[model samples]
Target: SEQTNKHLYLFEVLVKNIDINRNLLNDYEKDLVIKNPIRVRIIFSDFYDVEIDEVKDCKSIHLPEPEQVKCHSKMSRTATKEKNGKEKPKQPKQKQKVPEEMMYVKKTSLHSQKAGFSCLFPMEPMEMLEKLKTSSLYFLIFSNMGEDEAKKIIGQAKVDVRKNFIDSVQYASATGEFPTTANLTTSCKIENVFKEVSGRIEVYVRLSCFGKFIMSMFNMLYNERNPANKKTDEEEKKAETTS
Candidate 1:
């Protein structure tokens, strides 16, 4: 009875972004895990990204969960005069965007851990370790990038990546930190937007090709505290009764 209060180890997760472009999805190229307590947010990039009819334009997917994301944005530095007051041309600042046009949100969440991580997003470390031996896992990812760029990224990337099916992806930018305003140091920023294919048929396809095998680990010993789960088989019942 005391064990039912415990929670299972959640690993599988899915993150979905509304009105996101095919290019800006970093989740596509990396080996991200989908652990427990996952959250997913869907954003709308301007009115343009929204669909007129809910049937085709609605953005949703049943993908694996993404791992805990430690989002970090450093202060975008600008060109400045040194202590000598020498004019230093600004380093082409990696443009920070506060793109209003593409306002969107991403949805992320976690699920039950069923199989080995190697089977899902196998990479170097995951492969070397036997699937059952290791508790580690990796997940596949999808992007809103154009077919050409998505294809190229998938082609060059070691892991699996791709666009959704029959989907015509459109290119648009959400409003964010423009990196320039009245010569004042532009505060770097970001935005929200969805994606669509330009034209033709683009069926949503999932590829289980590759990824980075960060580690081979076992579920923490403390995770399986629930007596109900621990006693899923009958031998445990006898042990429990004897105890």
Candidate 2:
């Protein structure tokens, strides 16, 4: 059976590994020993006129101060080499740990209505994919909220959805591969999608689609099996009867 009101595409964006270049900052900003909170905004643009905006609070994520690594002197290196009779291999530096709050997750959905929904007929997956190819994602970074509560733009980045996600699905579909299911319940993750930004902002985006039928069945089964939901429904019914 055909299902209605299901999203053709769903994207989950995870923003992390955000490193702001202090050298890129203005002299006034660089002089400050302590900087203000940094804020991140995500925007998803499709073929439609409307763009989805996901804005996060300034204080939500706290960027940690950069670590200072001490350099070994030549004398120390020579002494170590002489003691061992050979130069020691360099140890790899460990990656910095990102805070839980610093990682932001945003979900965006593209529906058939946005592509041109019709009451008489359902939209096809191919048509939806065609429309999705033109979509793109935008990332904007800001530093230091002013007294008037305005964001100071620092850097920005853009990513094409087709290159990052849609094209891969199309290829998988054309090849009759098991990677993509019949219902298009497939997902792909992309890292470092941002480009042409002043500072480095690492991001991961996961694109997926679940047919309406599958989602509807899952919801129905979950409602039937959950006792807490049944109790709430019964309570609501009793309250209505009493009224």
Candidate 3:
């Protein structure tokens, strides 16, 4: 049966060696880590609204070849430039508007080799839960250990989850103000480091946060770069030429 209107959380883990030139590591350091390290990316997402289940059998999933994380925002900025000797007119920049409400998770101290890291979700419990139900969160764990070594270490690691009700009605009695937000944090760590792999390895981690919510609504197709839009524009140009 297809799953819909359901709340789901799945963690996607990837393991790969770090690229010396691409990563922030020196030649000697890169050489050391290359023999003993694995880069990891943990992608978390809410599959409640997805039509197809992405992670049906996630437990025994195999890691694919490593891929570099591109900065989409930067790519968008660069793609708007002129091409084919065509110069686009510059329009006046509009003032950016600030949003009324915002939520985020803050990491106090995060590292690759370390299994346990702290995450702080700054928002009300209900609000944060809603966000989780509608958004996808990513955690990048970089390691200086080889893929095999890193996997073994991660297999024995422990993850601890805790919730802190910062802003609550009862707590307001002592603090004189009602708490409006809650902090949800999790600590993860890999214990029992293997001795086979040595040297100071560095891991680069990236987290992707996506907000996708569906409340009684269906899918939305963005036409910004759709071929239909382009076809219409071309048709209009042809008509103009004929007229």
Give the range of the ten consecutive residues with the poorest summed lDDT in model 2. Answer: 110-119
- Best of the two (1, 3) by lDDT: 3
> Mind giving the per-residue lDDT tens digits that candidate 1 earns over 122-189?
22322222222322111122233333443211111011121210011111001111111110111111
Going through the candidates in order, what is the number of backbone clashes in each?
Answer: 51, 0, 13
Regions of candidate 1 where Cα sits further than 4 Å from its true position = 1-70, 86-218, 223-243
C-alpha lDDT score of every prediction, in listed order: 0.23, 0.42, 0.29
Q: Poorest 10 consecutive residues of model 1 by lDDT?
A: 165-174
Q: Candidate 3: where are CA atoms >4 Å away?
A: 1-4, 7-36, 41-155, 162-183, 186-188, 193-215, 219-243
Candidate 1 matches the true fold with a TM-score of 0.19
lDDT of 2 by residue, 1-243 (tens): 123333344434444345555555567755431344455556655432212222232222222211211111011111225465886644433333333223322212110000001011123456656666756666665554556766566666665566545665565445432233221212222222233335555555555454444445554576699978757756876988999
TM-score of each: 0.19, 0.44, 0.24
lDDT of 3 by residue, 1-243 (tens): 011222122221222221222244446545553344333334333321111111211222222221322211011111234777676655424322222221111111222222212122222224434444444433333333434543312222222211222123123223322223322333333222342212222223222211122211121232344668547656876988999
| lDDT at 36, model 1 | 14
How many Å off is the CA of 21 in candidate 2? Answer: 2.5
- Model 2 — TM-score against the truth? 0.44
Best by TM-score: 2
